[model samples]
Target: MSQLDTPRLPENASDLRSLYRAAEARAARLRVLVEAGQVLAGATPETLDAAVCEVARAAAHLAGYESGRVVEDRPGEAGDDNGLIFPLTSPGSDVTSPGALVLEGRRSAPSAEDREAVAVVCQLIGASLSARAREARLARLLGELLRGQEIERSRIAHELHDGVAQNAAALMRRLELASDGDPADLAKARDQARALVRELRRVIAGMRPPVLDDLGLVPALQHLAAEARASGMAIALEIAPDPGHRPPPAIETALFRIAQEALNNARAHAGPDVHVTLRLAYGAGRWRLSVRDDGCGFDPDAGRAAHDAGGLGLAYMRERIELLDGCLTITSAPGAGCSLLAEVPAA
Candidate 1:
């Protein structure tokens, strides 16, 4: 073989041995990371926690520690004094995560490579934990949606029993008493029939707005703005240029409902004379809807907590968007205005 193609060797036996040992150590570190990655990547919901623990165990063994324990990040709580704590970092965020991996004992300080391996393992764990938390939150929101549906049904039942049903019964009694052809009784029954029609129309609109099906989303929103304007509210509606293709029924319904609810909330909680703006924008393969009210705002954290305790607030909105692989965000403070934004992919 040519000299350039020949393999080179260390001049001394000790140097050769050292080189061999260094290569072996590098390979061992890489092998541990690979194995840990496999465990994490293939972990199912049932095996997630166990897989995380296994990764910790393997990392501890590689770090020259007897064992390791997970220490949750809590105020005024300290981890083991005798161990080295490696903070778990989230893949999405720069902050130190909720928990850390603490290697139990250090007869000698772990090498740089060992520390790096542990750090990487912690990142993997952080990402997995975040995903698990999101899954749990989504499940809770779904349960809330079901409960909200029941509550809505109860409200509709009450309206029917007290308003429509009661009015109908009174109209029937008036007609029966008017069998004598009395003009006053007949006129009263006619007025009652008209009133009943209006109430029925209101109920039907609440269930599903006719304008939405007949005129489409843009016109429906324009109708909404006109209604608000007639009620003496300063509101502006803006629609971005459309691609001329209507969104799927579910998307249209969701966006309209969200906008309606947001406007209602603004009217109820926002102080008098608060200006509101509603906008819809379209982008490549996605659409965005935003409602902003320059009114008295409230703590979003408190609102979210209230929903978690079953208040059916922004959490329900988020659940609706998330179901369509979308995102919903609410920004507000005690003095600042409230802005509710939702983005969904085109179907």
Candidate 2:
């Protein structure tokens, strides 16, 4: 009786000790998080990733892992090899699978004592690492988005300053010549002025597509389809009922921007012979914008990683959608085509 009871008492004591240690470790980690948060408050893109990596490595050490690194999860790097690959898995143990650890780590076996402790540590480490990864990703996306917006503004400024402004000056010159020439020349100059005015209006329309705000989502998509068809790309547009009746301004703006970005991407990078599809649908009080292009397709995940690092177009579209509480998903495989889907709450 003495031997059996003695064994029970030590086991209980060991359990209590484990609980105390775990609690203390958790408190210590919370303090570390507070410090990290303070640093993150003033962090910039150049230093954000490095900061996150340092925290992740520290967390790994605390969890008894040998090493930890921050990685971006993208095509060709999904699953175990994806973002922030940690050596939490075994030769084939699911206990260390990144996804599993993310969801919640479980014991490898009933009697696996050390594995249980490791699993808990993995959970804390994984949570912290994942949070840092997301923050870094968001920071990168914002930088790229701002860059794209600046480029667009510059392009528009140049077009107005060069194209429309030059043409208007030429029309003015012709008017002055007409004033000093024959009546016939004056009549010809008047005609020229009218034509120039029409051309200016067209340029303005290109600068700000009117259908986007005046006629709503379907009409804007239809106009885009018409423009694509004029460019030698076969275009198709489909709309579900109730999408255009009443939509949030933010959602409308996001969809318009995304559609414009998608078209520009297809034209600039995917070549002219691409087939394009623009669709808007309302379901369960949500609005979805989808753009599909049948051109040379690159890996969406890989492209997104590149985009997150610095590419402008897709990153801007994603940021715009995200700002409006929407979600952006891109799907593509090499030579298989690309589809971008954005969904926002209509309500």
Candidate 3:
């Protein structure tokens, strides 16, 4: 065979051993990357330190170093100079002082290949840490936004209940006392004032339901279903067996709001004689709330696009769920019905 066409093989035992070692190193590096991915996937503020430490240890193992550590480079603090240091830098940001990954007690100076592998691992770690930080910051902002919305709703509800509602009641009483006026005119005025009072009370309840705070989620949902029934919409509320357990106030508020929005959407879109179903279930370290209707449905993609373009009801529901680290899903088809399902961690 021509030399150019011949396949090459290791010529000696030493060469074979060298090839085997190189293969092993590559395998080790792959394993390290896989482990790092798992750590990053499950990362949270509570487990971040342990995750970083695990990544450092894996990098050190892959690079044939005795030990490695991740160090935050604080102001006025000295960093280790004896070992290889890889700075963790984020893109487009000068605000964060980069941390360092230090590898110590290497048997010999790292080869060019080894240094390259370590660099890749360091970059992975840095990106993961930066992503975790950004997620935490976004979560905080969402929490504040939800809290502000709740506060504003409470304020408006209080004003309507105490101001507008009270005035309407007083006007109704005045109409009742005017016996000298034309009987038909007085009756019509009194009815109009009473209707205004009922409408105002409904608005206040919708803005911020008192049952939600007083009796918790199940009772609040039941009350909502009763209201829907009164409005000529049939709403069925099904709660799991363990309805007594309550989540944190923020979580409860978020779930309630999401469910409320979903029901409102159904009431507005679903035609008469439609049966709406609301289900709440808790299990397996998570809780889920679902609202489903049998009325004509729209295209889910179109609905989602509309929501993205500032359809406040669905958008608000999604934001509230996401703020609590929950998931919201909408399902629909042209002739079928629409369903909204929200899930959050029970803990």
| Residue runs of model 3 more than 4 Å from their true location after superposition | 1-200, 307-311
lDDT of 3 by residue, 219-251 (tens): 888888898899898888899766568877887
CA shift of 280, model 1, Å: 1.9
Give per-residue CA lDDT, model 2, range 13-117, as digits (tens). 779998788788667666655555555445564666576556555544544444545443321212232222333322322222233222112212212333344
- Candidate lDDT scores, in order, read 0.82, 0.64, 0.75
Which residue pairs of candidate 3 clash? none
Q: Looking at candidate 1, what is the lDDT of residue 252?
A: 88
TM-score of 2: 0.62
TM-scores for candidates 1 onward, in order:
0.68, 0.62, 0.52
Clash count for each candidate, listed in order shown: 0, 1, 0
Best by lDDT: 1
What are the per-residue Cα lDDT tens digits for candidate 1 across 138-228? Answer: 6887787887788669878999999999999999999999999999999999999999999998788767789999877887788888878
Higher-scoring candidate on TM-score, 2 or 3 = 2
Per-residue lDDT value at 63 in model 2: 44
Backbone clashes (count) for model 3: 0
CA RMSD, predictions in order = 6.4, 8.9, 15.1
lDDT: the better of candidates 1 and 2? 1
